[model samples]
Target: MATMQSLAFSSPISSHRPHQQRSHTGLISSPWVICQSTHSSFNGQSLQLPQPRRVLLRGSSKLTGAITMMVKPVIQFIQGTDEQTVPDVRLTKSRDGTNGMAIFSFDEPSVFDSTGELGEITGFYMIDEEGVLSSVDVNAKFVNGKPARIEAKYIMRTPRDWDRFMRFMERYSDANGLQFVKK
Candidate 1:
């Protein structure tokens, strides 16, 4: 077991107070980043620890770029579901990991039942060999009262939550035969 050690800060950290206004969800291309201590690991193996705390990281452009590479995942398209492969559909998440949106055109809108014999709206989920990565209640756009395309938004309010999602994506991509490319 790798011993957990405190990362001493050169400058004493002041009490952190979250801003009342929420930070806008955007890509982390700039030279600033936020961080939190959620998981610990050794030699590429993850170890879940009992201590839970928030970590904020602010440093030079070099540090920012390195952290960005670690957290910023290559965006990907959801090829299809377990039953079949559907093309031209993609999922995008905010760089800060606040939220994600998935959208695709509905070729056969008539097949949609809106409610699957239940009172709740239709929902979409991405499940791999392991389990569901994320899910959201589906909403569709219409043209002349006919469904044209569908979209769903899921939320992950913190960087920690986003990290978990990325782990799921790693496994989901492997099982689904999907590849993420930088463009």
Candidate 2:
């Protein structure tokens, strides 16, 4: 079983740009700042940011450091009954970067160790600035596989709903023993 971990840190320079819209599918529209972290990680690899870049609200804002190198964001289960083959999952970020959609496949026999049309899992989540995750929706084909699907939707969010929706992802990640990598 592989253990999953979510890391969150405060940015030295947090500048918010208002009145801008992002061109992403799953992100919410709001005032967002470019997060330029000094130290970052992607899939357990250490990364460094180049410089502070102003993100345009009308398009997809790229995060510098470890995240820019990957083609897509993915969540992999490090420890689970299905640990033999880490489930292949994909993440779609929303325009504002606070919301996300997670997709899991049961179609690949070797990837999920399942045959036939076992269907797929789709999860929607909201992440606050405090790095808490709130489930907006979670759909699954099999009930026994709920944990895997739920965990895959985990990610960071803006602090828009921290008080009401505040829930630490680290606790959940630690409890489930899962690790996530942002590409």
Give the top-scoring candidate (TM-score): 1
Q: Tens digits of per-residue lDDT for model 2 on 27-125?
A: 233244334442323222223434433444444764433212111111222111122222334544554545444443322222244322443422333
Q: Give per-model TM-scores.
A: 0.37, 0.24
Candidate 1 TM-score, true structure as reference? 0.37
Q: Model 2: how far is 41 from its true place, Å?
A: 3.7
lDDT of each: 0.38, 0.32
Q: Taking the tens digit of each residue's C-alpha lDDT, what string does model 1 give over 34-110?
A: 44433332113363533323334566532323223121222212312121222233555565445544343333332
- RMSD values for the candidates in order, in angstroms, are 18.9, 17.1
lDDT of 1 at 85: 26
How far in Å is the alpha carbon of 136 misplaced in model 1?
4.7
